[model samples]
Target: MFLILFFFTGFTIIAFISFLDDIYSLPSRYRLIFQFCGILLLLCQVYYSSPYSYWLFFFLSILSVGIVNAYNFMDGINGITGIYSLILIICLSYVNNFITTFIEEDFIITIILSVSVFLFFNFRKKAICFGGDVGSVGIAFLLVFFTGQLINTTYDWKYLFFFSIYGLDTIYTILFRLSKKQNIFEAHKLHFFQILVYQTGFSHLQVAAGYAISQLLLNIWIINYSASNPLFYLPILFLLVIMHFIRKKQGLAITIK
Candidate 1:
Protein backbone atom coordinates (compact mmCIF):
# COMPACT_ATOMS: atom_id res chain seq x y z
CA MET A 1 0.00 0.00 0.00
CA PHE A 2 2.71 2.41 0.89
CA LEU A 3 4.65 1.40 -2.22
CA ILE A 4 1.68 2.12 -4.42
CA LEU A 5 1.16 5.46 -2.72
CA PHE A 6 4.74 6.52 -3.23
CA PHE A 7 4.75 5.47 -6.86
CA PHE A 8 1.55 7.27 -7.72
CA THR A 9 2.57 10.35 -5.79
CA GLY A 10 5.78 10.51 -7.76
CA PHE A 11 3.92 9.99 -11.00
CA THR A 12 1.50 12.75 -10.10
CA ILE A 13 4.30 15.13 -9.41
CA ILE A 14 5.94 14.46 -12.76
CA ALA A 15 2.68 14.55 -14.68
CA PHE A 16 1.41 17.73 -13.09
CA ILE A 17 4.56 19.67 -13.84
CA SER A 18 4.67 18.28 -17.34
CA PHE A 19 1.09 19.32 -18.01
CA LEU A 20 1.87 22.80 -16.71
CA ASP A 21 4.86 22.96 -19.05
CA ASP A 22 2.58 22.03 -21.89
CA ILE A 23 0.30 24.96 -21.11
CA TYR A 24 2.74 27.62 -19.91
CA SER A 25 6.04 26.65 -21.54
CA LEU A 26 7.96 26.45 -18.31
CA PRO A 27 11.73 26.72 -18.24
CA SER A 28 13.63 23.50 -18.87
CA ARG A 29 15.47 23.75 -15.56
CA TYR A 30 12.20 23.98 -13.63
CA ARG A 31 10.88 20.93 -15.40
CA LEU A 32 14.11 19.01 -14.76
CA ILE A 33 13.98 19.83 -11.07
CA PHE A 34 10.49 18.41 -10.72
CA GLN A 35 11.42 15.41 -12.82
CA PHE A 36 14.39 14.69 -10.59
CA CYS A 37 12.27 15.05 -7.51
CA GLY A 38 9.69 12.65 -8.85
CA ILE A 39 12.32 10.10 -9.82
CA LEU A 40 13.94 10.49 -6.43
CA LEU A 41 10.67 9.55 -4.80
CA LEU A 42 10.53 6.45 -6.97
CA LEU A 43 14.09 5.57 -6.02
CA CYS A 44 13.17 5.84 -2.37
CA GLN A 45 10.48 3.27 -2.92
CA VAL A 46 12.98 0.99 -4.61
CA TYR A 47 15.32 1.45 -1.73
CA TYR A 48 12.68 0.47 0.79
CA SER A 49 11.56 -2.55 -1.20
CA SER A 50 14.17 -4.74 -2.92
CA PRO A 51 17.09 -2.38 -3.08
CA TYR A 52 19.90 -2.84 -5.57
CA SER A 53 23.50 -1.73 -5.44
CA TYR A 54 24.23 1.95 -5.22
CA TRP A 55 25.76 2.02 -8.68
CA LEU A 56 22.70 0.39 -10.23
CA PHE A 57 20.45 2.92 -8.55
CA PHE A 58 22.63 5.74 -9.76
CA PHE A 59 22.56 4.41 -13.31
CA LEU A 60 18.80 4.00 -13.21
CA SER A 61 18.40 7.60 -12.04
CA ILE A 62 20.38 8.90 -15.00
CA LEU A 63 18.62 6.59 -17.41
CA SER A 64 15.21 7.55 -16.08
CA VAL A 65 15.82 11.24 -16.63
CA GLY A 66 17.18 10.59 -20.11
CA ILE A 67 14.19 8.48 -21.09
CA VAL A 68 11.68 11.03 -19.83
CA ASN A 69 13.36 13.76 -21.83
CA ALA A 70 13.81 11.51 -24.84
CA TYR A 71 10.14 10.67 -24.89
CA ASN A 72 9.37 14.40 -24.80
CA PHE A 73 11.89 15.13 -27.53
CA MET A 74 10.60 12.36 -29.79
CA ASP A 75 6.98 13.54 -29.63
CA GLY A 76 7.29 15.72 -32.71
CA ILE A 77 4.76 14.11 -35.02
CA ASN A 78 1.34 12.52 -35.09
CA GLY A 79 0.85 8.99 -33.77
CA ILE A 80 4.50 8.22 -33.07
CA THR A 81 4.28 8.34 -29.31
CA GLY A 82 0.80 6.86 -29.21
CA ILE A 83 1.60 4.02 -31.54
CA TYR A 84 5.05 3.28 -30.22
CA SER A 85 3.94 3.34 -26.62
CA LEU A 86 0.94 1.16 -27.34
CA ILE A 87 3.12 -1.45 -28.98
CA LEU A 88 5.64 -1.27 -26.15
CA ILE A 89 2.97 -1.69 -23.49
CA ILE A 90 1.58 -4.68 -25.33
CA CYS A 91 5.01 -6.23 -25.49
CA LEU A 92 5.57 -5.55 -21.84
CA SER A 93 2.22 -7.14 -21.13
CA TYR A 94 3.41 -10.28 -22.83
CA VAL A 95 6.53 -10.26 -20.70
CA ASN A 96 4.45 -9.83 -17.61
CA ASN A 97 2.17 -12.69 -18.52
CA PHE A 98 4.58 -15.19 -19.99
CA ILE A 99 8.17 -14.30 -19.27
CA THR A 100 8.15 -12.88 -15.75
CA THR A 101 5.35 -11.60 -13.62
CA PHE A 102 6.96 -8.57 -12.11
CA ILE A 103 3.98 -6.26 -12.23
CA GLU A 104 0.24 -6.69 -12.16
CA GLU A 105 -1.34 -7.89 -15.37
CA ASP A 106 -4.33 -5.63 -14.83
CA PHE A 107 -2.14 -2.57 -14.64
CA ILE A 108 -0.48 -3.37 -17.96
CA ILE A 109 -3.87 -3.98 -19.49
CA THR A 110 -5.08 -0.58 -18.35
CA ILE A 111 -2.09 1.14 -19.91
CA ILE A 112 -2.55 -0.83 -23.10
CA LEU A 113 -6.15 0.26 -23.33
CA SER A 114 -5.26 3.85 -22.58
CA VAL A 115 -2.68 3.95 -25.31
CA SER A 116 -5.14 2.38 -27.71
CA VAL A 117 -7.60 5.18 -27.03
CA PHE A 118 -4.90 7.78 -27.49
CA LEU A 119 -3.96 6.19 -30.80
CA PHE A 120 -7.52 6.27 -32.02
CA PHE A 121 -7.41 10.05 -31.92
CA ASN A 122 -3.77 10.67 -32.80
CA PHE A 123 -2.90 7.95 -35.30
CA ARG A 124 -3.76 9.98 -38.36
CA LYS A 125 -2.29 12.50 -40.73
CA LYS A 126 -4.21 15.26 -39.04
CA ALA A 127 -4.17 14.34 -35.37
CA ILE A 128 -7.02 15.57 -33.26
CA CYS A 129 -4.87 15.78 -30.15
CA PHE A 130 -1.15 15.91 -29.48
CA GLY A 131 0.51 14.12 -26.60
CA GLY A 132 2.59 17.17 -25.68
CA ASP A 133 5.08 16.84 -22.81
CA VAL A 134 2.51 15.66 -20.31
CA GLY A 135 1.41 12.60 -22.23
CA SER A 136 4.90 11.70 -23.41
CA VAL A 137 6.79 12.12 -20.16
CA GLY A 138 4.06 10.57 -18.07
CA ILE A 139 4.02 7.44 -20.18
CA ALA A 140 7.80 7.39 -20.24
CA PHE A 141 7.95 7.42 -16.47
CA LEU A 142 5.47 4.57 -16.24
CA LEU A 143 7.46 2.56 -18.73
CA VAL A 144 10.65 3.17 -16.79
CA PHE A 145 8.97 2.01 -13.61
CA PHE A 146 7.54 -1.11 -15.18
CA THR A 147 10.75 -1.99 -16.98
CA GLY A 148 12.70 -1.42 -13.80
CA GLN A 149 10.39 -3.78 -11.95
CA LEU A 150 10.82 -6.48 -14.54
CA ILE A 151 14.58 -6.13 -14.50
CA ASN A 152 14.72 -6.19 -10.76
CA THR A 153 12.52 -9.29 -10.61
CA THR A 154 14.51 -11.28 -13.13
CA TYR A 155 17.92 -9.67 -12.66
CA ASP A 156 18.39 -9.62 -16.41
CA TRP A 157 19.67 -6.50 -18.11
CA LYS A 158 18.48 -7.77 -21.47
CA TYR A 159 15.10 -6.22 -20.74
CA LEU A 160 16.63 -2.92 -21.72
CA PHE A 161 16.11 -3.97 -25.32
CA PHE A 162 12.51 -2.89 -24.86
CA PHE A 163 13.72 0.66 -25.29
CA SER A 164 16.20 0.00 -28.09
CA ILE A 165 14.49 1.90 -30.87
CA TYR A 166 14.09 5.15 -29.02
CA GLY A 167 17.44 4.80 -27.28
CA LEU A 168 19.24 4.25 -30.56
CA ASP A 169 17.61 7.24 -32.17
CA THR A 170 18.18 9.51 -29.19
CA ILE A 171 21.82 8.53 -28.66
CA TYR A 172 22.72 8.73 -32.33
CA THR A 173 21.09 12.11 -32.73
CA ILE A 174 22.99 13.45 -29.75
CA LEU A 175 26.27 12.19 -31.18
CA PHE A 176 25.45 13.70 -34.55
CA ARG A 177 24.74 17.06 -32.93
CA LEU A 178 27.94 16.91 -30.90
CA SER A 179 29.95 16.17 -34.05
CA LYS A 180 28.72 19.43 -35.54
CA LYS A 181 29.34 21.31 -32.26
CA GLN A 182 25.60 22.03 -32.01
CA ASN A 183 23.79 22.42 -28.75
CA ILE A 184 22.32 18.98 -28.09
CA PHE A 185 19.50 20.37 -26.01
CA GLU A 186 18.19 22.61 -28.72
CA ALA A 187 15.25 21.34 -30.73
CA HIS A 188 15.99 20.11 -34.23
CA LYS A 189 14.62 17.81 -36.89
CA LEU A 190 17.62 15.53 -36.99
CA HIS A 191 16.01 12.49 -35.46
CA PHE A 192 15.79 9.56 -37.85
CA PHE A 193 12.00 9.62 -37.85
CA GLN A 194 11.96 13.36 -38.32
CA ILE A 195 14.25 13.10 -41.31
CA LEU A 196 12.07 10.41 -42.81
CA VAL A 197 9.05 12.62 -42.41
CA TYR A 198 10.41 16.03 -43.46
CA GLN A 199 13.08 15.02 -45.94
CA THR A 200 11.99 11.74 -47.51
CA GLY A 201 8.36 12.56 -48.11
CA PHE A 202 6.99 9.75 -45.95
CA SER A 203 3.61 10.51 -44.48
CA HIS A 204 3.45 10.99 -40.75
CA LEU A 205 1.44 7.82 -40.28
CA GLN A 206 3.88 5.90 -42.43
CA VAL A 207 6.89 6.89 -40.37
CA ALA A 208 5.03 6.26 -37.15
CA ALA A 209 3.90 2.85 -38.28
CA GLY A 210 7.40 1.99 -39.43
CA TYR A 211 8.88 2.83 -36.05
CA ALA A 212 6.25 0.88 -34.15
CA ILE A 213 6.58 -2.11 -36.42
CA SER A 214 10.35 -2.06 -36.18
CA GLN A 215 10.17 -2.07 -32.43
CA LEU A 216 7.58 -4.82 -32.46
CA LEU A 217 9.80 -6.97 -34.61
CA LEU A 218 12.74 -6.32 -32.36
CA ASN A 219 10.68 -7.15 -29.32
CA ILE A 220 9.62 -10.41 -30.87
CA TRP A 221 13.23 -11.31 -31.43
CA ILE A 222 14.21 -10.36 -27.92
CA ILE A 223 11.42 -12.40 -26.40
CA ASN A 224 12.19 -15.46 -28.46
CA TYR A 225 15.95 -15.63 -29.02
CA SER A 226 17.81 -12.92 -27.16
CA ALA A 227 17.05 -14.53 -23.83
CA SER A 228 18.75 -17.78 -24.76
CA ASN A 229 21.70 -16.43 -26.68
CA PRO A 230 23.38 -13.10 -26.28
CA LEU A 231 24.68 -13.33 -29.84
CA PHE A 232 21.17 -12.53 -31.01
CA TYR A 233 22.04 -8.94 -30.34
CA LEU A 234 24.31 -9.02 -33.39
CA PRO A 235 21.40 -9.01 -35.79
CA ILE A 236 19.69 -6.29 -33.80
CA LEU A 237 22.89 -4.28 -33.78
CA PHE A 238 23.26 -4.75 -37.52
CA LEU A 239 19.74 -3.52 -38.07
CA LEU A 240 20.37 -0.44 -35.95
CA VAL A 241 23.58 0.24 -37.83
CA ILE A 242 21.68 0.14 -41.08
CA MET A 243 19.12 2.52 -39.67
CA HIS A 244 21.86 4.90 -38.55
CA PHE A 245 23.47 4.83 -41.99
CA ILE A 246 20.19 5.61 -43.68
CA ARG A 247 19.50 8.46 -41.33
CA LYS A 248 22.93 9.94 -41.93
CA LYS A 249 22.59 9.64 -45.67
CA GLN A 250 19.34 11.55 -45.57
CA GLY A 251 20.15 14.05 -42.82
CA LEU A 252 23.79 15.01 -43.34
CA ALA A 253 23.19 18.15 -45.36
CA ILE A 254 19.93 19.22 -43.81
CA THR A 255 19.96 22.40 -41.74
CA ILE A 256 17.33 23.61 -39.34
CA LYS A 257 16.53 27.24 -38.69
Candidate 2:
Protein backbone atom coordinates (compact mmCIF):
# COMPACT_ATOMS: atom_id res chain seq x y z
CA MET A 1 0.00 0.00 0.00
CA PHE A 2 2.74 2.42 0.84
CA LEU A 3 4.60 1.48 -2.27
CA ILE A 4 1.58 2.08 -4.44
CA LEU A 5 0.86 5.46 -2.96
CA PHE A 6 4.46 6.57 -3.16
CA PHE A 7 4.69 5.70 -6.83
CA PHE A 8 1.36 7.36 -7.58
CA THR A 9 2.35 10.55 -5.86
CA GLY A 10 5.58 10.60 -7.78
CA PHE A 11 3.73 9.90 -11.02
CA THR A 12 1.32 12.73 -10.34
CA ILE A 13 4.16 15.15 -9.78
CA ILE A 14 5.97 14.10 -12.94
CA ALA A 15 2.81 14.13 -15.00
CA PHE A 16 1.86 17.56 -13.72
CA ILE A 17 5.21 18.90 -14.79
CA SER A 18 4.85 17.25 -18.15
CA PHE A 19 1.32 18.57 -18.60
CA LEU A 20 2.66 22.07 -18.00
CA ASP A 21 5.36 21.43 -20.59
CA ASP A 22 2.76 20.29 -23.08
CA ILE A 23 1.44 23.85 -23.04
CA TYR A 24 4.39 26.06 -22.19
CA SER A 25 7.39 23.99 -23.23
CA LEU A 26 9.19 23.60 -19.92
CA PRO A 27 12.95 23.58 -19.92
CA SER A 28 14.53 20.23 -20.67
CA ARG A 29 16.61 20.30 -17.50
CA TYR A 30 13.57 20.78 -15.31
CA ARG A 31 11.80 17.90 -17.01
CA LEU A 32 14.83 15.72 -16.48
CA ILE A 33 14.92 16.67 -12.84
CA PHE A 34 11.29 15.73 -12.34
CA GLN A 35 11.86 12.46 -14.17
CA PHE A 36 14.78 11.73 -11.89
CA CYS A 37 12.64 12.46 -8.84
CA GLY A 38 10.06 9.99 -10.06
CA ILE A 39 12.83 7.45 -10.59
CA LEU A 40 14.03 7.92 -7.03
CA LEU A 41 10.56 7.41 -5.60
CA LEU A 42 10.14 4.17 -7.49
CA LEU A 43 13.57 3.01 -6.37
CA CYS A 44 12.67 3.77 -2.79
CA GLN A 45 9.52 1.70 -3.12
CA VAL A 46 11.55 -1.21 -4.48
CA TYR A 47 14.09 -0.95 -1.70
CA TYR A 48 11.47 -0.96 1.01
CA SER A 49 9.56 -3.92 -0.37
CA SER A 50 12.26 -6.24 -1.61
CA PRO A 51 15.69 -7.56 -0.85
CA TYR A 52 18.33 -5.12 -1.96
CA SER A 53 20.62 -5.72 -4.88
CA TYR A 54 22.46 -2.56 -5.79
CA TRP A 55 22.90 -3.57 -9.39
CA LEU A 56 19.28 -4.56 -9.87
CA PHE A 57 18.08 -1.38 -8.22
CA PHE A 58 20.21 0.74 -10.51
CA PHE A 59 19.06 -1.14 -13.59
CA LEU A 60 15.40 -0.91 -12.66
CA SER A 61 15.68 2.84 -11.99
CA ILE A 62 17.29 3.36 -15.38
CA LEU A 63 14.79 1.12 -17.15
CA SER A 64 11.84 2.77 -15.43
CA VAL A 65 12.95 6.22 -16.57
CA GLY A 66 13.65 4.88 -20.04
CA ILE A 67 10.16 3.43 -20.35
CA VAL A 68 8.61 6.69 -19.22
CA ASN A 69 10.56 8.63 -21.85
CA ALA A 70 10.11 6.02 -24.58
CA TYR A 71 6.37 5.90 -24.10
CA ASN A 72 6.25 9.68 -24.30
CA PHE A 73 8.40 9.75 -27.41
CA MET A 74 6.22 7.15 -29.13
CA ASP A 75 3.14 9.24 -28.40
CA GLY A 76 3.89 11.20 -31.60
CA ILE A 77 0.87 9.93 -33.51
CA ASN A 78 -2.78 9.46 -32.78
CA GLY A 79 -4.15 6.05 -31.72
CA ILE A 80 -0.70 4.56 -31.19
CA THR A 81 -0.73 5.04 -27.44
CA GLY A 82 -4.32 3.96 -27.02
CA ILE A 83 -4.03 0.89 -29.22
CA TYR A 84 -0.57 -0.19 -28.10
CA SER A 85 -1.31 0.45 -24.44
CA LEU A 86 -4.52 -1.53 -24.70
CA ILE A 87 -2.61 -4.49 -26.11
CA LEU A 88 0.05 -4.29 -23.43
CA ILE A 89 -2.41 -4.00 -20.56
CA ILE A 90 -4.45 -6.88 -21.92
CA CYS A 91 -1.38 -9.07 -22.08
CA LEU A 92 -0.33 -8.11 -18.60
CA SER A 93 -3.83 -8.86 -17.31
CA TYR A 94 -3.74 -12.28 -18.93
CA VAL A 95 -0.39 -13.11 -17.40
CA ASN A 96 -1.62 -12.02 -14.02
CA ASN A 97 -4.64 -14.29 -14.19
CA PHE A 98 -3.29 -17.46 -15.78
CA ILE A 99 0.46 -17.32 -15.42
CA THR A 100 1.34 -15.43 -12.27
CA THR A 101 -0.67 -13.19 -10.03
CA PHE A 102 1.96 -10.60 -9.47
CA ILE A 103 -0.18 -7.45 -9.54
CA GLU A 104 -3.76 -6.56 -8.79
CA GLU A 105 -6.23 -7.71 -11.45
CA ASP A 106 -8.40 -4.67 -10.74
CA PHE A 107 -5.55 -2.36 -11.63
CA ILE A 108 -5.20 -3.95 -15.03
CA ILE A 109 -8.92 -3.76 -15.67
CA THR A 110 -9.04 -0.11 -14.67
CA ILE A 111 -6.27 0.78 -17.08
CA ILE A 112 -7.94 -1.18 -19.87
CA LEU A 113 -11.25 0.52 -19.30
CA SER A 114 -9.62 3.94 -19.10
CA VAL A 115 -7.67 3.27 -22.27
CA SER A 116 -10.88 2.16 -23.96
CA VAL A 117 -12.37 5.60 -23.33
CA PHE A 118 -9.21 7.25 -24.59
CA LEU A 119 -9.27 5.10 -27.71
CA PHE A 120 -12.80 6.15 -28.43
CA PHE A 121 -11.68 9.73 -28.82
CA ASN A 122 -8.32 9.12 -30.45
CA PHE A 123 -8.66 5.98 -32.56
CA ARG A 124 -10.88 7.37 -35.26
CA LYS A 125 -10.20 9.15 -38.56
CA LYS A 126 -9.78 12.32 -36.55
CA ALA A 127 -8.40 12.64 -33.06
CA ILE A 128 -10.23 14.72 -30.45
CA CYS A 129 -7.48 14.94 -27.90
CA PHE A 130 -3.96 13.62 -27.50
CA GLY A 131 -2.64 11.72 -24.48
CA GLY A 132 0.02 14.36 -24.12
CA ASP A 133 2.82 14.00 -21.57
CA VAL A 134 0.50 13.62 -18.60
CA GLY A 135 -1.39 10.67 -20.02
CA SER A 136 1.65 8.94 -21.48
CA VAL A 137 3.91 9.41 -18.47
CA GLY A 138 1.24 8.39 -15.98
CA ILE A 139 0.52 5.20 -17.88
CA ALA A 140 4.21 4.46 -18.31
CA PHE A 141 4.85 4.82 -14.60
CA LEU A 142 2.03 2.41 -13.84
CA LEU A 143 3.35 -0.12 -16.32
CA VAL A 144 6.92 0.09 -15.09
CA PHE A 145 5.86 -0.58 -11.52
CA PHE A 146 3.70 -3.51 -12.55
CA THR A 147 6.40 -4.93 -14.78
CA GLY A 148 8.98 -4.58 -12.04
CA GLN A 149 6.70 -6.47 -9.68
CA LEU A 150 6.24 -9.26 -12.20
CA ILE A 151 9.95 -9.59 -12.80
CA ASN A 152 10.65 -9.68 -9.09
CA THR A 153 7.98 -12.27 -8.47
CA THR A 154 8.59 -14.59 -11.42
CA TYR A 155 12.23 -13.90 -12.06
CA ASP A 156 11.37 -14.00 -15.73
CA TRP A 157 13.40 -11.82 -18.02
CA LYS A 158 11.26 -12.85 -20.97
CA TYR A 159 8.61 -10.44 -19.78
CA LEU A 160 10.85 -7.63 -20.91
CA PHE A 161 9.68 -8.51 -24.42
CA PHE A 162 6.51 -6.55 -23.62
CA PHE A 163 8.26 -3.37 -24.71
CA SER A 164 10.26 -5.04 -27.45
CA ILE A 165 8.85 -3.13 -30.39
CA TYR A 166 9.16 0.32 -28.89
CA GLY A 167 12.50 -0.50 -27.33
CA LEU A 168 13.92 -1.66 -30.64
CA ASP A 169 12.80 1.41 -32.50
CA THR A 170 13.98 3.87 -29.87
CA ILE A 171 17.30 2.15 -29.18
CA TYR A 172 18.07 1.63 -32.83
CA THR A 173 17.15 5.18 -33.75
CA ILE A 174 19.39 6.57 -31.04
CA LEU A 175 22.26 4.35 -32.16
CA PHE A 176 21.72 5.27 -35.78
CA ARG A 177 21.90 8.94 -34.81
CA LEU A 178 25.05 8.34 -32.82
CA SER A 179 26.64 6.59 -35.77
CA LYS A 180 26.03 9.68 -37.88
CA LYS A 181 27.36 11.99 -35.16
CA GLN A 182 23.93 13.51 -34.81
CA ASN A 183 22.58 14.79 -31.51
CA ILE A 184 20.47 11.88 -30.29
CA PHE A 185 18.67 14.08 -27.81
CA GLU A 186 17.40 16.41 -30.50
CA ALA A 187 13.81 15.88 -31.71
CA HIS A 188 13.62 14.04 -35.02
CA LYS A 189 11.34 11.75 -36.99
CA LEU A 190 13.67 8.94 -37.99
CA HIS A 191 11.90 6.26 -35.96
CA PHE A 192 11.01 3.42 -38.30
CA PHE A 193 7.34 3.91 -37.54
CA GLN A 194 7.75 7.62 -38.15
CA ILE A 195 9.50 6.89 -41.40
CA LEU A 196 6.60 4.69 -42.39
CA VAL A 197 4.16 7.50 -41.84
CA TYR A 198 6.25 10.45 -43.06
CA GLN A 199 8.32 8.92 -45.84
CA THR A 200 6.35 5.91 -47.07
CA GLY A 201 2.95 7.56 -46.83
CA PHE A 202 1.43 5.16 -44.34
CA SER A 203 -1.42 6.54 -42.30
CA HIS A 204 -0.99 6.95 -38.55
CA LEU A 205 -3.67 4.41 -37.77
CA GLN A 206 -2.09 1.83 -40.06
CA VAL A 207 1.32 2.23 -38.46
CA ALA A 208 -0.14 2.13 -34.97
CA ALA A 209 -2.12 -0.98 -35.76
CA GLY A 210 0.97 -2.61 -37.20
CA TYR A 211 2.83 -2.16 -33.94
CA ALA A 212 -0.09 -3.32 -31.79
CA ILE A 213 -0.65 -6.40 -33.92
CA SER A 214 3.03 -7.30 -33.95
CA GLN A 215 3.23 -6.89 -30.18
CA LEU A 216 0.10 -8.98 -29.67
CA LEU A 217 1.69 -11.82 -31.61
CA LEU A 218 4.88 -11.51 -29.58
CA ASN A 219 2.92 -11.61 -26.32
CA ILE A 220 1.17 -14.77 -27.39
CA TRP A 221 4.53 -16.35 -28.16
CA ILE A 222 5.99 -15.34 -24.82
CA ILE A 223 3.03 -16.70 -22.88
CA ASN A 224 3.55 -20.11 -24.49
CA TYR A 225 7.32 -20.28 -24.21
CA SER A 226 9.54 -20.93 -21.23
CA ALA A 227 11.18 -17.76 -20.00
CA SER A 228 14.12 -19.75 -18.61
CA ASN A 229 15.17 -20.87 -22.06
CA PRO A 230 17.77 -18.85 -23.89
CA LEU A 231 15.79 -19.23 -27.11
CA PHE A 232 13.04 -16.98 -25.81
CA TYR A 233 14.79 -14.02 -27.42
CA LEU A 234 14.91 -15.57 -30.89
CA PRO A 235 11.45 -14.45 -31.94
CA ILE A 236 12.16 -10.83 -31.07
CA LEU A 237 15.46 -11.05 -32.92
CA PHE A 238 13.69 -12.45 -35.99
CA LEU A 239 11.15 -9.65 -35.97
CA LEU A 240 13.89 -7.06 -35.57
CA VAL A 241 15.66 -8.46 -38.64
CA ILE A 242 12.47 -8.26 -40.67
CA MET A 243 11.88 -4.67 -39.57
CA HIS A 244 15.47 -3.81 -40.45
CA PHE A 245 15.10 -5.13 -43.96
CA ILE A 246 11.82 -3.32 -44.48
CA ARG A 247 13.35 -0.03 -43.35
CA LYS A 248 16.42 -0.66 -45.49
CA LYS A 249 14.21 -1.16 -48.54
CA GLN A 250 12.68 2.28 -48.04
CA GLY A 251 16.10 3.83 -48.75
CA LEU A 252 15.37 7.00 -46.80
CA ALA A 253 18.41 8.73 -45.46
CA ILE A 254 18.44 9.06 -41.71
CA THR A 255 21.05 11.75 -42.27
CA ILE A 256 18.51 13.90 -44.06
CA LYS A 257 17.00 15.32 -40.89
| TM-score against native, each model | 0.94, 0.94
Q: Give per-residue CA lDDT, model 1, range 66-141, as digits (tens).
A: 9889989888889999999988899999989888898889999999889999899999878898788999999999
TM for candidate 2 is 0.94
Q: How well does candidate 2 score on lDDT at residue 23?
A: 94
Error of 1 at 124 (Å): 0.9
- Taken over the whole model, the C-alpha lDDT of each candidate is 0.86, 0.84
Worst 10 residues of 2 by lDDT: 248-257
Q: Residues 1-257, candidate 2, lDDT per residue (tens digit)? A: 77777777787778888999899988788988898888778767755667758888778777878888999889888899889989999999998999899878998899899999999999976899788988988888878777877877887777888998888988887877787789877888888889888888999999999999999999998888987777888988998898788778887454555
Clashing pairs in 2: none
